[model samples]
Target: VAVFTDVDCAYCRVLASHLGGYLADGIALQFIASPLSSRGTPTYMAAENVWCAVHPHKAFIKAYSGGVPAPAPRPCAVIVAHDSQVAHAMGLPGTPGLIGPHGAVLGGYLSPRDLLARLRMDAATEPSP
Candidate 1:
């Protein structure tokens, strides 16, 4: 799944806690920062810091796990901005927008089981390449 996420969304933190559930279901997550969703939130800076961390993936885990990411190695405004633009172009409503394998965008929080079920259904209906 490609998730459009805000680095510090409370609901996103809840979802992050279920990472094991997602892994058990054979789902891998690709997190795309949506700092543009930072209207009333404070995660925009966190998003930049995460993206610029030496080990960005680990930084994501830390951020979503309710821990602060390490300081960025370099300036990261551009990449973070680009990610937000891509999310906006994809029509993501807000943080935690999940894009299934077949390009279906599901919004908000879903348990791993629910996510797997939806993915399975979508896959079943999609034509094989």
Candidate 2:
């Protein structure tokens, strides 16, 4: 379960808020943190800031939930660069995109129940090793 997300999207915030719910049920949710620079929404920059923060993942979740402004104006270009590479490799050009085990893209805002169902379906349909 790979979720590519941007910090500035309202839907992204909603999705993150449900991570715990999904995980509580034994779902392994991996993230790709895709930044949306083309939207001119400061998501990419904020992502860079979050990635550069001491607690990168936590800072991102907090900032995405509207807790505080970027930890600082400066950010690590390397971190942003790596994330960009990840986005390109994964063919993700927008925030709130998902790659389930079944090779399906789950995009847009989805409630936790919907997400759990999608993941379950994908997992059930996946070819076993």
Candidate 3:
């Protein structure tokens, strides 16, 4: 699944906190940063920093879990801006939008168990190869 997430959104944090459960259910998450904080704000800066981090996934997990240590402003071009643009184009209502493996949009935050159930249902409905 691909999750359009924002670093500052509380529900996004909740989803991130249970990421392991999703993975345990064979749901691999591809996290795309959609910073709710407008450009030039500290929240946006943190998102940018996480994108530029040596270990971006770990940095993102840390940011949502508690806080990400501020890093020196680097010259790396972060993709969070583009991610936000894509989310807008997709007409996503909010952060933590989960796009299923078959491109079904499951908008909003869903508990890991619920999400796993949905994924299983979707898979079962798919035409067999």
Candidate 4:
């Protein structure tokens, strides 16, 4: 699944917290950075930092689990801006916008179990390989 997420969104944090649940159910998440804050803001910078981190997944987890510590404001050649543009183009309403394997969009927060159920339903309806 691909998730359009904002680092500072509370609901995004909740979804991130249950990532383990999704993983346990064999769901692999592809996180796309879509900062809610405008450019040059703290939130945007933090999102950039996460994209630039040596371990982006770990950085993202740290950011949502607690708070992202201030990192040196260095220029990042990351895809955060591109991700934001793509999310906007997709007409996503807000953070935690989930794109399922078959391109189904599930906007807003869903518990891990609900997500797994939805995915399973989708899989059941797919044409066999």
The lDDT values for all models are: 0.82, 0.72, 0.83, 0.85
TM-score of 3: 0.89
* TM-scores for candidates 1 onward, in order: 0.89, 0.77, 0.89, 0.89
Candidate 4 shows a clash count of 0
In model 2, pairs of residues that clash are none
Candidate 3 positional error at 25, Å: 0.8
Candidate 1 ranges beyond 4 A from true positions: 37-42
Backbone clashes, each candidate: 0, 0, 0, 0
lDDT of 3 at 19: 83
lDDT of 4 by residue, 33-106 (tens): 99988889989988988888877777888899887745735667357888998889988989989999888887
- The pairs that clash in candidate 1 are none
What does candidate 3's lDDT look like per residue over 18-112, in tens digits?
98898888889998878877888988888888887877877887899888745735645448788888888888888988898888898789998
Q: Which parts of model 2 are misplaced by more than 4 Å?
A: 38-41, 69-75
Question: What RMSD, rounded to one decimal, does every model reach?
Answer: 2.1, 2.9, 1.8, 1.9
Order of all candidates by lDDT, from best down to worst?
4, 3, 1, 2
Q: lDDT at 50 for candidate 1? A: 88
Better of 1 and 4 by lDDT: 4
lDDT of 2 by residue, 11-122 (tens): 7888788878878876677766577774235766677667777777778777867876455555576766676677777676576877776667776666778878877777
